[model samples]
Target: MKHPTSYRTSIIGRTAGRLGVLTAACLTALAVAAPAEASTFSYPGHGVAVVHDRATTHADRAHPDQYRDSFAIHELGAVFGLGADNRATAVSAGCSASHPCRSIALSFQIVTMAGSHVRINATNLGRAVNEQCPGCQTLAGAYQFIVSTPAPFSLDAQARNQLAVIHHRLDALQTSNASIDDIKQRADALAAQVKTILDRAAAAAPKDREVNPLGTTGPSVTMHRHFDGPS
Candidate 1:
């Protein structure tokens, strides 16, 4: 007759096999649920580029000088505009008093990845005031960034962080009715989170281990990134 212990071992092995199969099925489900997201904008090869014109307009009108400030916030980082123009031109100071304003055409490329998160390395192609010459009207202001997400539950964490920041900004703006402040706060927070995720992912990777088992080994996730253009 077979020993009881031997029979128990056989049973245990069968159970382990079933558990592995279940785990694989769950992972497959997660991968199926995860979705890819992206956004893009195109600007005319020529003309001025405007960054945060809406917010800047308010700031310029509110402040003594026609000075306005804006920022491009992404999950990876944020870029604040020191100055800008409607047409693609070299970053220049305020238009001369004689030529207070200039009309310039522009195009834009904006991509948002995942529902609440923005990716870096997303390219922005447009023309604005040339930063080199604060007063010159030449093709200027072309910004590019490399936005990266993290591994090991990185996507989920980033999404949560972004949602939290969005809610906080919405609340603050609604309470004070400060549109610019609200936008800025939300943008900054999102950029910080994206950067954090990317940084963490980079750090987690081993120098010699090119393969990130944590990101690819497990079940996948569903993600969405949203983008809205100028109305």
Candidate 2:
């Protein structure tokens, strides 16, 4: 793998020239298997592989001057997936209605998606995170990073089959002609087994999250990550 690139915060959403991370065949397989997830995080770059895009409005009672006004607009990416890229990126937007947005400092992490069950390259996901969004940026101290929210991407074929098998077992248990107590016993056993399986899957599954514990302290703020499409 190449040495990780340095990322700086920019109010204007832009991308430097990118190097290809995978061959055509590998990239094709990844495109088909990994679908866009719906969740996101802020202050990324820890263990997670993807950061879904999100936005939030924060008010700073102490330093309103740092922001255009008191409140600032923060745009963060969704958490990372296992088979995705290691370095995640997000932007920070200022509060001013008239001012343009900008990216944040320490905006990315350096990771290599190796040592996992799946091996999906992260080129496409990385590009999407850095280049796709427009007017993406926020003011200083608008976003917070407390912990990583694990957002798993679509399971590969084998993982899906494993899940399907568990579902089938649950269905069979529901239809079995047994006393409630007996069914409960059997179901309990099944649940234990399922937990074991899920644990393994979770270990192998492509997971993502952000890393920002002890974020800027203020009243708890609600952040919204928007990737739904044009208004």
Candidate 3:
């Protein structure tokens, strides 16, 4: 006696209610099992970070400098130098101009600098590598950088534009195996310098309150990041 559409709708509603109950129960169980101070949420796949390194294509024959710059491709200071100390040893003691350490399978990362105010961590991405350097102190891994700021701040239109430009340059670095020389040349031709752009962006931000606690305004901010990769 009931309409087909109405009967199907009733059945669908009941099924949905059952599914909702099941989902809630599973979540509650997971919450109990999870740690007390678990800081991160499971990624919902909105944004994904990838290591677009050229050296990976020719790992066995890649130069140390080439391998090093691959990681430095990400230019943000907020997300630079993650697993750097480990990477540095290989650069300084591992190889030199005379005794080149060929066949580098060095693991590198760029992480946010630790601060009392901010808790920084990274969501690691699995990028498998064959051990080309035997008995070497190394890690072969990648990461998507994460930062939790002390205070919540919104990006203004100007700030958003500046960030867009920075992202473009970083994308170029990631996609190309361009040498420092070629990069510099292109920048020179275009009259754009990475340091200058970053300095301008930093200047636009408020002065460090801690730097001048007594005064209303702080001193000029000088922010710099240098890549200390092998030559």
Estimate the TM-score of every prediction.
0.25, 0.26, 0.30
**Which candidate would rank higher by TM-score, 1 or 3?**
3
Question: Which regions in candidate 2 have their CA more than 4 angstroms from the true location?
Answer: 1-151, 206-231
lDDT, candidate 3, 49-146, per-residue tens: 11222113122223332222223323222211122111211221243344333222222232222112221222233232224433222222222222
Considering summed lDDT, which 10 consecutive residues are worst modelled in model 3?
7-16
**lDDT tens digits, residue span 99-177, model 2:** 3333221111112122212223333111112233334432211111112123323334674465456445544542344
Better of 1 and 2 by lDDT: 2
21: Cα error in model 2, Å = 32
Report the CA-based lDDT of candidate 2 relative to the real structure. Answer: 0.28
Clashes of 2: 31
Winning model by lDDT = 2
Model 1 clash number: 40
* Candidate 1 worst ten-residue window by lDDT: 7-16
